[model samples]
Target: MYPEPVWTEWEDPDDFAEAFQLHVERHGENVYRLHKAITAQGFKIDPQTLYTWKRGDKEPRSATGLRVLKAIERRYRLPDGYFSSKLAHSGRMITGGGLEKLSVVERRRLAWHLPDNFDLLPRAKRAEILAWVRTVIISGATDYRRYHANAVLHRFSFRFSEGASPLPFPKPRPLEERLADEGAPEVGRPVQTERAPIILDTEARDLRLFKTATLTTGGRGRNGVWNDETANQKMEHLGLLFGALAACPEGEVRGYGAPVRCMTFAVLLFPAVWDWYLRWREIKRGFFTRWESEMLTVVAGLTRQGTGWLRQSPHLAGYLRPIAGLITPADIVAATEDWDGVCETIHRHAIVRAKEVDRVARVHRDPFEPILTILEADSPLGEYRKISEEVRRRRPDRRRFPVAAAEATRGYLMIRMGLHLGLRQKNLRQLLVVPRGRSPTPERQLEALKRGELRWSDRDGGWEVFVPAVAFKNAGSTFFRKSPLRLILPDLSGLYDEIDVWLRLDRKALLKTQPDPRTFFVKTVKNKSNSGAYEQHKFYEAWRSIIQRYGIYNPYTGRGAIEGLLPHGPHNVRDVLATHVLKQTGSYEQASYAIQDTPDTIAEHYGRFLPQDKAALVAQVLNQVWGS
Candidate 1:
């Protein structure tokens, strides 16, 4: 039997060099003898290489390095993966073995999944491994995933410069001048199509004013100010609208070739323009969608009677000019004289248009498609927990891979906390964090800010969450009744330990020197531009990324937890919670409590408990009588 080597201070070796040296000492072997033994076994290794490993100069990473380690392990009579497991704890990814042929991105992605002896494998075997990894792990082969992949390839949107001023409309050029301009150049220059028009300074200023007016409180006849999220949504919606208008009919967007230079806020005054845009959307998508309906609603808000910014700004009508097919000079003159009447007409038209679009609107994307596997389960909550488990299992060594470790911890908490709270994305992203010793944020302050907080509850003797009713989207619902939500978090699955680590070390590591947004979750701070706050879109992406990495099981790699799982955002957690409650209690009211919603809402939207599922539940109790 190989005897354990006595250390000077009795500290166990962790790095490869110390461990290798200790094993060598235990076997009464030196570097020369190990080198000779390895060479004799048809594995070529230098004596100096063993010396370097002993001196802790470098640890094994490549296939050859692994082979040498295995030979040393064999010489010492140690268990398989003994040295490699120790190397894993070193924090550097074991790569560069069979991955020489792959790109930098591919190597990084495949490093965790690939075996140490990957390079020693046959060419055919390597190809098979690469193919499987790419298909299952790198590129998910789901039908909707395929659709998304293909959809992003065609970029149709245009970006407008905010600084550019409106140029004077060019008069018709003489026929000879036009012909001469049209003539091909003699040089090797590439021919270019007509460029998209730059947004004028006036046009940019109008948009800024419109957004400001909408966001400002208590404007004349104004209903309410838009929140930050709503304001952003409007900005994006209008950007797409104008981008489509400027797009060429012959191009990928296949839009009506309205001259962007001639188009201004005045275009919103004409009913013909809105109708054309609606029809274009319908034709492009091959059916009416909720997008068109929502867009119509936005237009209605923009041109509403007394409160409408466009209704008040009659001067914008003068900026309108004639386009070849879309607009006429006569339309501009008419709009300038009766801007308020034009606004009233467009406002009414939008309302009517919205209803029409809604009647025929088809559901383009199924909200439940990505999470069908989780929802169809008897215990959806239990099924979804597998993702959190996968994250915990794959958590990198904190000592070696601090950033990756922090990210893994963050991902794990995101899944765990989401399942527990069943809160919407906005609430989850904006949930403030207060450390255990710190005073919890007051209920009044939280209500004023329309946000929530996670803090230690000294009275309850556990971690607690307090969310003001006003912070919720459904604050007026019967569920709240003006009462705030308060829950003491049970310390399940080492939750407290993980949370402590996150608050003390991982959170600080992720934030670095960046100004903390004080949210429970923080983005991995890589640069000055990264504010460490989770915006709506970025937060959704982070959740989806977690699902992609840990939730979706790859049969080839055997890494992820769940089978048949697709990438999903945090919102799907509500469906899982609702469906789980419904299955267990067979009470819609009870299910609604899980998601802080109403029974009717759960039945209509969240819970997918069909008639057959209900019948099966009843049948289970009835069948027990016969068995007895």
Candidate 2:
């Protein structure tokens, strides 16, 4: 059966008011004029109604109401997606576009066209022109009608060529007159002037008007003067020009919108510009470098005359007194040398400090005897036997049941297997206890135990457990390809018999509920939810509690909890496996291959042996090896 679609309309005056206020504030005075213009154009609504609609005071009455809303949208020159119901669903308000609509290709073409006619205007006028250009570019206006207004304004305000010749203004002239103009002498054509001649004062004074205007616009004459507004205007002009250049195809601007977009543009473009300037030192006969160096020298002179370092600091710039000493070439060289030395010294100090920090942070706080020492202990296994015997002695009384007896037994067996196999936690979690071959009852416990496979090859015709890489951390790498671990047992048949008895006695109930017959780890009476497994944290806790209750402490360090247990919640079991493997093999390469630790790291950290007593370790390993 088909269901009917449902829709709901929403209205909120306060939200609308707030949204409108924010829009006005961000777009500035022009927004108010736009609002007035829209109202005066004679829509059947009052200005207040329009305001209320914009503020969310009223929902659009119908689809026709949406057309009115679209009119307001056009006035603000909003982005394509603005005012759509999608904004309502997404909980965002409509606002004027901060010029993010342009495509990458369009922006590149705009940038290429800019440098040709950029220089011949007053700072404020230049800023206005660039701002309009930015708007046109962002609006994606490729057609003449869409961008013609801005282009006309820009051409009217600035000379398009070096001779101060005006740009050609489009007019309704006759075709015959235009053709006659095209036949004029070529000698009067405007020349393209490079920056070098102007900088060197080789060109006539009138030809240097653009550079002179820049300085004057910033309120600094040949003798220097204070004009705050001029400085601001010049800065605004430079920002616009740089921003436009950065938007060009060659520039590396990223992202969209104001502030962050501008910052992204600067982050990408500035490095490229700096790199090019550096390289130009060789190719351009050092002209660019010399000019930059001279500019820096002038700045340094101004900074040093009265302020010194305090005056030169960015924080105190406006507060500093003017100075007059010129920075010499020797001074520049010396400063560079000092900076390099300081940086080198700081880097060396950082390395030393990091080592000191690491030494202090490496505190391991476990309260258990090391497993090796416990295994080596003269009567470690005997202690367990004694405890079991005592519990048996008091078995007539149910209250005398051994505390954590099941957990202690299970944890001891699991840890022994982990130490032997170096299996990671994920693989251990998914391990099952199923019979090998055609036996009705399970024989051997296999890993990577996929369904229906009684046995599979382990690479070299040896019996092994296959483990998949997805169970490993670096599963994507080809280095640790799906491999098998040899199932080498001292008495394989006897081991299988013991496992069969354990499963029959301990996990019979849990096995009944599972639909799949191939699963290995059956739920036991001790773990009620026994759908074949426990969480990693629960397993760690069980191990920790058992070790603590047993009072097992390492003989060498006198610590009791697992060797490297940390409160990183769980997952240290994997590390324990890795550490034990490394200790046994005495070869990082072997340990890495067995435990999935990178061979490179193993070589770096555990490659060499420390001066520890061999006697205590060998005895402990032997005792623990047989689970005595």
Candidate 3:
């Protein structure tokens, strides 16, 4: 016996364990008594399970686990969510909730989003519910999204491992020898055409030096070094270039079948090599795309005289191995002996080739294709807000699905911030948060880190976002004039309340016990991944996921915010903002201010102010005479 209960006033428990223990003690009962009472009430829960729950060793995860907590609440004469609300959002898959019909992977993903009474529902009803969740939430059923899902599976680009320096990869067996050993492919099956390029020791070093170094060892004739992101893009681009060069012509890639051993960086110095590669790309793609133009631009920079990487690094010539038609043995000798003259010749050829590629470079994929519904609207920003509304409408139950609820809240704020700030993806994901009543991070520190901060502003009486000029990709643009970006976030549409709730509860739920990355938006912490920070690809996926789940309409299930909406990323928000202003004001200057860009940039890239939109604006003003 627990010695007749004394009147002890306990502080509110911060968690399920504390709450459970406090209630049991206040009632002057032990776990055995509590278990017996629950059993008497027709609920069979393990005595040890009660002990574990009391001890904070485990709380509840599955529906059964939750039911046991409900029974305990009833025994204690507490509210339905008394103990349940205090449980941590473990983010682990919640099973044993009538998901037996689902595949193991499906069960893992759908468990958190399922209703509490999901198991009790009829078999046909469960199937209907699952179909909706799978289509709208998991698959993001949209035309473009479906296409993207399939497209990513057929990866043709090379992936350089992180921290991969210019060093020799393991020597690959000759293609013919390896193929013979594996035997011939079946008639119907697709043949493996492109093997990862086997880079030599010299070529790898040159590749490294070209991308990472600020200046060549000699420190002459170069434009600039590539940033990490740019460097990665270049590596991927170059990988595709090399992969196409090495792929078998007979196979699907329809590539040149150049010897893997001879595919050195030196091949880039030859005019004929560039010509062959350029022509092969055009043939493969069936039209000129920006890819060809971008690749040519990279080549021109690499081979440009006085500062070109290939020109400055003469030793690359020594590594050149002849590819029968592309590079003759004599050409290699000539290039090695007269590196400067050969570079000068190739540099001129590259410049001429780049101009030719640009003339025919068709826009392969329209940037606006995904969000045409939003962008084509008279009020694009107004139309875009439907996504946030949809997110709020479809938000899950917080007590039962804390992590999912937090994720929904985060998605809402992500769209809100993107609309208000129009900051690039890097600037947005890296933006830090300092809650109300806390001292803001110093501007100098933000500039040093090249990130922005969202903080409470007592003077402005609203939330303020401050990012240094140096944080922007276009820091030197005349729009900034070296001034930092400062904007007071409008406290509208429950924006302030949402931010406060996120900081107080939702954000922490997503982080769990993981170390806070200090960023406003965080990835849901799981066992496999502990960090709460958003990487580039993960961040892009997060934005796209939000759009997929809420933005695109599905006629079959009758969910989503907009009809004909496709999956797009954070960058598309800038287009939305710019176009919105352009439609209203008909001034590129005002439109530029919306996204912090120059009028020329808005005219050329951002704003989609069609001739009709411009004419309509003029007609609206001119028609004022008829109204009078």
Candidate 4:
């Protein structure tokens, strides 16, 4: 029997009347009521007007207008694209309007009107605004219009404007011209001024503001002051003031704010200011010199002695009195000729703490070795070897072995796989063996191994475990890619197959303890008491224990365990693979392609052909070529 078609009609006709009628019938009475409601809400325009919107006759008014249209769609229970034409028109209008001209101040006002939270705009948009503001400032666009634009940018945060409203000029000027003008004084003669040590009452307000601003901006912290861009700006202003004062006659330096003097200030102030300016120049090219004026004011205040300063100054003399004891012949040579005796005296007195400075420099100079050692020795591979050796020596029975041996092996596997794959602990825990469709569980461990598909093809050859995006730290939609260390090993395919067999055998019993079919690593009785089932912390502890057991010392660290391995983590395996490939091929380009590493990184970390192993590697290669 033929079924009768449902017939429905829209009361208020529009360009999409036929489609709307069809949609109303398909969606039922609830949708029809929604359509009527939307039409009643002043959206019941003529069909031709709707058609104009659909056919690009007009544009959408604003983002709000688009939202209104979307609301209508929701009310009528329409498909996503049902009112897409109207929404898109609205979008075009808004996009065009966004480019409309506005003065710098107006722009700032607009930006202020935007949501207060940081995340309101996309990162790219924020970056664009930041870049634009920099460009405008660099271009010396100091007019009211430009400043208004700057104000708009400043509305995003004080960090953007550095707490000052954008400079307002009546018109744009060249950077050079602006600098020249700024350098010139407004009056030919100096204003009435007096030079005196800083009085607590007079300088108090400005000093307070300075301290508050510095603290609020994250300048002062436990680690010492952070020399950020704003600090650099201040330093430049100081430099300018210093230069100006130096040029001025000694007596003419009259109107200085305060006279404060401390030896530490005398030693550090100029250098610190210079360094800040240098760093600022490195980060941003051609920031003009307002720093000199500001720095002069600070210096003036430092010349005054507070009660706190008076108390602290005497302590400094005794503290470094033994610096002379530490001075060496090399230190004498390094010291300037004029200051050599002074330097030696400082070193002998123990006043300078030179060794501490040297130690800090050394650590900074070579950070890679220590950091890698710490991470790797505490890794899974190191742990595994430890446990395996323990079990082999003990030779415990099968029941006890499962409890001790299997637990150890599992920890090792997790660490090994995690480092090799660079999977975060949570994602590593969530890893599952993708099953073949229409297949039931098999009793055979080897069959289960064959069924589990969790591997990826390597660049060189063979397969390694493939870590999907869900398992990655970033939680991206795309899979996190990595190549296996086996690719660089001799008989790569054979080694991979051996690892596969090893995993299958080890996981066989553990598989039976799974709480759900989707869970990959099943908890055996040994690991049942472990928190989170597969916690990374447990893996770390197990690794540390294994390192102590195996006594594997890194040659670099003179310490036992995998911590000696350079560039730790799953990535280190890749580094090792890349290093070996470079050695084997003796071709930088080929090695780079094989391991997918940059030439620079490879050269820096992996390219060094160890002196001890060089002869043996070459001999082996030569023998292979000669059929020895």
**Model 4 stretches with alpha carbons more than 4 Å out:** 1-396, 411-431, 435-464, 468-538, 551-575, 587-596, 606-608, 611-628
Candidate 4 residue-wise lDDT, 1-628, digit = tens:
1112354454433333344444445555434354355567665534444444444444334444454446656655555545543122111222222334656554442332122221235677655654543333222223433434443332110011223222221232332332232222212223222231122112222222333343432232222222333344443343333322222222232212111211112222223333443343323223323232233334433322331121112222211111111222332223323232332332232222223223332211222332333323323234424433432333222232344444445544544454344343344554555332323233244222322224334454444344322223233221224322222223322344434543555565554454444434545534444422444444344443433322333222122333333212233334434445555655556545533445665666544445444565567777897884
Scored by TM-score, the top model is 1
The sequence of per-residue lDDT tens digits that candidate 3 reaches over residues 1-628 is: 1234445576886666788899898988888887887788677678898898888777677677777777777766677677755666533454554666668886766664455546667878777877876765666556545655664554444444445345543444443343233222122323242434445434544565556675555456567766566677777777777666665666665666666656667788888878888888778656777778778778778777666777777766545666767777668768868988888787778778778888878866677877788888989999999999988876765775777899999999999999999999999999999989999999899988889999999999999999999888788899999999999999889999999999999989988899988999999888888589999999999998888667877553345799877767899999999999999999999999988889999998889989999999999999999999
Listed per model in order, the count of residue pairs whose N, CA or C atoms clash below 3 Å is 0, 23, 3, 49
Q: Write the per-residue lDDT of candidate 2 for residues 1-628, one digit (tens) a residue.
A: 1112132222322233344554444445334465566656665555566556555545443333444556655655554324532222111121112213556565443332232123334566546645644443223223333334443332111111233212222222342332233221122222221132121111112222323343432232233322323333333332333232222222122101111111111111122332332343333232232333432232232223222221222221111111112122332233233533322332344344334434433212221223333323333333333322322221211112122222333444454445445565545545543344433322233322321121323343322344544445455454556543335433332334434443444344434454433433323334355444555556555444434322332222122332321122123334444344445554556657655657775555422223342444466677896895
Worst 10 residues of 4 by lDDT: 316-325
Alpha-carbon lDDT, every model: 0.74, 0.35, 0.76, 0.35
The candidate, 1 or 3, that scores higher on TM-score is 1
Top lDDT prediction, candidate number: 3
Evaluate candidate 3 by giving its C-alpha RMSD to the native, one decimal.
8.9
> How many residue pairs clash in model 2?
23
TM-score of predicted structure 1? 0.80
Model 1: per-residue Cα lDDT over 571-608, one tens digit each: 99999999999888898999999889899999988998
lDDT of 3 at 271: 81
Provide the clash count, candidate 3.
Answer: 3
| Candidate 4: residue 43 Cα off by (Å) | 99
Q: Using lDDT as the measure, what is the rank order of every candidate, best first? A: 3, 1, 4, 2
Return the lDDT, model 2, position 302: 27
Name the regions of candidate 1 deviating beyond 4 angstroms: 1-60, 63-103, 113-139, 142-144, 151-219, 307-309, 527-530, 624-628
